[model samples]
Target chain A: MTALTSAVTAPGVLGRSRALVRPALKEAVGRMHPWVGEMAAYSFGWCEVGGGPAVASGGKGVRQALAVLGAEAAGAPGRAGVPAAVAVELVHTFSLLHDDIMDGDAARRRRPTVWKAYGTGPAVLAGDGLFALAVETLAGTSAGPAALRLLSASLGDLVRGQADDLLFATRPWAGARRVRPGEYLAMAEHKTGALLGCSAALGAVLGGAPPAVVTGLDRAGRHLGVAFQIVDDVLGIWGDPEVTGKPVHGDLREGKKTYPVLAALDAPSPATAHLVTVLESAGDPAVAAALIDEAGGRTAALAEARRHVAAAEAALAGLPIPAGAADDLRSLLDFLVCRDL
Target chain B: MTALTSAVTAPGVLGRSRALVRPALKEAVGRMHPWVGEMAAYSFGWCEVGGGPAVASGGKGVRQALAVLGAEAAGAPGRAGVPAAVAVELVHTFSLLHDDIMDGDAARRRRPTVWKAYGTGPAVLAGDGLFALAVETLAGTSAGPAALRLLSASLGDLVRGQADDLLFATRPWAGARRVRPGEYLAMAEHKTGALLGCSAALGAVLGGAPPAVVTGLDRAGRHLGVAFQIVDDVLGIWGDPEVTGKPVHGDLREGKKTYPVLAALDAPSPATAHLVTVLESAGDPAVAAALIDEAGGRTAALAEARRHVAAAEAALAGLPIPAGAADDLRSLLDFLVCRDL
Candidate 1:
């Protein structure tokens, strides 16, 4: 298949996907939660009746793209990936909803976060509903046993990753030290990579790809997930506020022990000392940003993120897909991990 | 099958269930959020491994038992309900973990609560793990489509009910003020009944019982769940400390809007005024208990529970099964909704 135009590739896939996903997502929402239209519209950055743009934001739908791409790569030709993509997206939505609540995050997609808008109770309930809807939808898939296992295992990782994140958050002992690159990669893999892996895995499985091909796609997804996370970490700390729709140095302000801080900590500098003290102090964002910059933390963090992205790109070398498909996938990875948004 | 004598029955079904449930529950604890175990252990009445003779301290294990019994009633026969039972219990455990944290309740099953034993973060993660594990286990169950659907929908209700409960707590508006008995029943049915329904439903589906039988069993489970919650409400107010292991009028102390309180609220009087005032007020448990008695709320709650028990009994009528099995089920309901401990 010819590679779609660069500008249109993602939007094109999402546009096609929205057609399939919209109705299923709507029905699933109804089945799973009350005030479904309102919550979903608010979540998707659409008005209650899809009236207009609810927010100036949304994801590139990369994971759903993986599900779609995996199915194509596995030779299920036309849109067999639709159902799997919807299910994967639902799980992703669920994770985002709950994670925001747990972290007390107040914004998403340049708008009030689910918990912030609807309160924690509704946010949690909506998340749970999405989770159930994901599983229920997966069970309905024609891909059958393999699809079931893939989705279930992915759900497990989602929880386990969440557990690790929460554990890392509260356990001073666990997170006190700066994160090593390897450890950071592993955390990223668990926290984000696993679901992407499931996305590709489901696509491959449902599309009837050979076992080795399935394995290759899974690895590709893991690498992609890690890369995505590292990029996210970079954006979290230093991305332009206009593009990212978040304050610069947000992570430092939150005292988040992301890759750069962890890397910097290992160098045994006074900055590390100042940083720790700053994190302990709970100052305003300006103070936190000043401290982080003074420490030269942002550049170091970006370098670490770059290293992970390089590694992720290297993992894609083994896939035997057609050249255009491979390039599209590569471009997608770069777009995700390097974009301003 | 011949009816087992009560002497024989005590150690037969109940005894074996204890044996089955104990080890599984242990394994579950071992595997959950590692941070949450200390708190969870305390809530489960363990100071350490092999801690004090495992208190008959846990609930009737009604949720789990319903799964087990449902399996039999539905015909997957011996022990097929175990997985579903385990899953339902995990859901139950999840609720309790969060409920304690939410209510700031300091004790459970006669021991320090999860949040009390460990801390809020660990407690929340622990509860979250249990919720994850519930679906995780069901993924491994032998019951095909039906069981999966049953379990997923059950979990959906459990979360939604929790949301409702939380919403009610935060906003006690007129709807909340005049909370009808039916609404209370609906709440309990959703919060409590749904899980139990899944339990029984799993059994019937796995057991290969006909669809009608499964439907009948589901209705019975709903009645049983309502009966259980009402009974629990009664125990919360006036049951013996030795038997209940919780503080007398503990629900009232927490100002939980249970069925009895709602019933009295509907027909306002000096008693209802006092009861409502105490619930709306913030003070000591002793003061609250005194107000409950002054309002004649305790007796009314108990009477209401008995009414529910009778309704529960009526729902079990004409279930297609051997007389002895039906009798055992009836006795089991009594053991569930009527038992002191």
Candidate 2:
């Protein structure tokens, strides 16, 4: 476990898959409208403000690694998953580009979000371009239509999750109209879980895995997604802004019904009631954070994350895959949950 | 020719295909998120302002007809094209939904747009949902990977064209930065042609046509799209508001660089110079419209449309399709260019 943790801690795991996926992803993006391509580069952090080469590259490429590793799990050449890795990464990029605009987030990766760097219209158009590139990345290949279907269906889930997230924001903070934990979980699963599942499913399918293995990886990925989302919810409320590359306590400020907020509100206590009152008036995010943590939301959330991680582990167990691949997938899963930022 | 014109005037051609595609399209739309589904209904004119049924239906279903007729031309049963038809139409709707937002359009089809009825975020999300559904509609079917690839490739063209269109709006009306006629034609063909071409190509591929015929229909549709766009450009300025269901001379006011504007500007006449002056100061759209007409822009545009229409006819002439199917396709082409609105 220590060795695995250290391996994950070195950043090489994410960087390895990121290196494989980035070239193909950039090529696909380069084939789009040139202006939109520039915006896409900015979205990926391959370029700085004026489209120069970036000092640092983009995200951790977790989904890409899931894809690349998912293929390896099926005993295929890990490179066989490049297309799937590119597709999922492109889809993930597409979601972030649009989500930033819809969520009105100003920063990502310690820089302005795409919509903040470019205007909303261009950002949206670039996002659409990435989405198209995602589909084309798979369709252009010899990958079966089933892989394309897996990718496409997840897109519906992604948008629906986003739509529900937006709608939940407008709902009241208390009473019948209040967003329930179960409902939020469902939305999170759709928004987050579906894509992760699709990433693994796509790779497994393309790698010529049997239906059972493909479906198993998909299930495992989905459970991992739930755990990953819980971690994100925690980071959104409690992580340092500099570390997370976003405004800290944003979920509290946005009045978003993240799992912690819901868990805190769900508990019936004087502090809980006071937390609701503070949230109702759009109170200080710090105070809201304290109230939520004081109500045991943090502990409850960590427990739930562990539960989901266990479920993910259970799904991963008994899979007809090589032992080495299983270890890699488990390590990544552990890294995602335990990630501080 | 008179008889063909009368047949095209009857509206039955559009209606026939519309009826076939509606149920499947509706069923697809119904499977989406309910709230987003309602917004899609509003987008399709399936429902009125408040979610009730509309007396008037949606667009003429030209793309759907292209797909269906394209399959029929390939000697398959017309129903073989249904999935292709649904996919193309969904893509079309997705473009319009997003385009309306980008264009800041408030009224479409004499009613408030999705963004106007719903908010910008919801409308954008609904458009994205429709796009996913479009891909899913094809991927869920037994359509060959080729058909899906054709559909996927065209999305890149569609978004690129759209991005260029937006960028074109901000360019100087005259200069090196001026939107050139050739460039605009290329943009129009992409913005308008790619999907139309894909519609025909999807149908042909799904209907088991050989590559030659599929490629032929794609070319024919691309040419027809240019003609269709020229006709639209003409109407954008000179057509009656009541008949077009839009503000008359809206393109002139919006400063959109349509074919007529480019042509009128290209002609080095006093009227053309005055047209430039008027446009620069944001003079009356009526005056600009008259100046454009005086500079022979209308005639030149019509001639350009006729040339593209002839090119389309030539592309269709030697295709290995049924004679009856060819005639039906030709009739639709003619109807599209000769449409009043």
Candidate 3:
């Protein structure tokens, strides 16, 4: 049967693929120092390495699985490639840890953020340590010179993008009054998409996939990240607390210029104007929910997200993926952009 | 003449070597984008690319010279190794830029620090940019895998050391009473020694020197860094402001627990006890300086610095250095720890 048919008919392929990748991640992480392994286990919602009960829960681990699957899809699945997968996860964790600090967020994964638990200095060090470890892992990989360069360059982009985002947050006046959609897309690409690109690219680099396949996978990941960020922004305002671990309309209250806000800002409406006004003040749930709904902001943002998802799918269409891999990728993309509380 | 003899005979060798390294640094820096080049020129006291006069007078550029001369001492003195030399300097500058911010230092190299000039955000981004650029350069080099690993590992050590230092600083319990000399040495290793070791080893890496020789250079660099740091601590309390660019007795006033301070704390005399008491209190320069003087802290610190300098010299002994290079190295070592101001 075709991958699409298997995905539609059986649907177990997704779970099975996830099962395949999860062990690789666990085995790879087990190699870290006992303390780092414990911290990581806690970070990932695996068994409590900290003497707590063995609670198993986490954000999808989709990025890491994607890295493993990406390598497999390109026809190189082995013990050699697992470290790159670990590296990707480390980079992802580093970003999340630092982002929590930068955003002054207190909770993560149903627990206190690293900074809240360990204090800011150690948290920063932990993040930095993880980042160092990530790059260091690549050195031992058989991925060779070109891959190292690509990884380094992608990291540079990730940090640069983050710098831009932080700068925008701290000094909005420095940015243009109305950022073009292209600029928003670029920002998303850097801040969110770059690591996903690294995930795909690192996989392909390790797998020794042809350049064309690598490029396609990279494009696929970029679009997937863009779609993911848009949906994330939507969920930020409209998501349920149970699902997101964040209060509804939190981003709106915080005056975040998410895609929805940017989209609404671009096309002026009375509702958008109201949003702009209330944005300066914190939005209570009733007012925020109404403002988001009345402006058709969530709907517009969903549509935008779908567009990027479709683009991502189209990009993946060109890749010469292995058996069952395509279905897993498709399912992963679907899971990334489509859940609600 | 031997390096020791020339040190007493001709101090100009060190000065001339410094001159050679300066223009090479300027040329390499000039190749970056106009904005970065401009910032760097202002930082390095070079002329603006658009034919204007120099922005500010440059400092000693001692780190870059160390890298170049160290490489030359290993016997490959050509431009082939210059990229590594340039890269080491960039890494040093990146560290200094961030360190200045972290330390809340206002002046560096007789000019406003990057943080002071461009605000914290830009300064951080610029430092990050330099770091990325340095890695990119090293990755692009023809240097072997071992060399890249060494450089990357050094950078990691630098971060780890820095993280530990910051953690030590912020921990409320880590004051004079709690801080230890070992901790101070560890901080110095990370903050100052790691890069110096990298600088010395880069030459051997480029020269394809035997592993033993490289290890010897590394050991030499570490001892030299310790000696340099001890002298720096001495200067912080007793050096002239015209040379050090900060007030005399600055470390005492800042309540910094340097090696000397920690030593004093270990076995307190009456005056040492009083100095510690003042440091524990307001850290007023007038009171602290008087107490430090009464304690004969300057003489004690100088004696300690002399011991380390001797150790550094001993570490360099027996290495089959190129003719005249050893003498120059010895001279530089003496000048480093023997600076009166």
TM-score of each: 0.80, 0.95, 0.80
Q: Report how closely model 2 matches the true complex, as a DockQ value.
A: 0.75
Q: Per-residue CA lDDT of candidate 2, range B32-77, in tens?
A: 9988999988888888766787875588888999998888989997
Write the residue-wise lDDT of candidate 3 on B160-245 in tens digits: 67765765555432254477767777778767777887777776677766676677777777767776887788778767888777
Candidate 3 regions exceeding 4 Å error are: A1-59, A110-123, A170-176, A268-300, A338-341, B1-59, B100-127, B167-183, B267-304, B314-317, B324-328
* Candidates in descending DockQ order: 2, 1, 3
Looking at chain B only, the TM-scores across the models are 0.80, 0.95, 0.86
Q: Specify the CAPRI tier of model 3.
A: acceptable
**Cα lDDT for residue B92, model 1?**
80
lDDT of 1 by residue, A1-341 (tens): 12334455655655665665567566766675455335655676655323455544556677777877777777675267767887888888878877787777787766778778776546655666677677778777666556766677666666666766765565441244534556666767877988888887787777778877777777778877776776677677767778877778777766776765665555446666766666667666566555555666666666766665666566667766666556656666656665432
Q: Score the docking of each candidate (DockQ).
A: 0.31, 0.75, 0.25
TM-score of chain A of each: 0.84, 0.94, 0.85
Q: TM-score: which candidate is best?
A: 2
lDDT of 3 by residue, A301-328 (tens): 7887888888878888878888566767
* lDDT score for residue B69 of model 3: 61
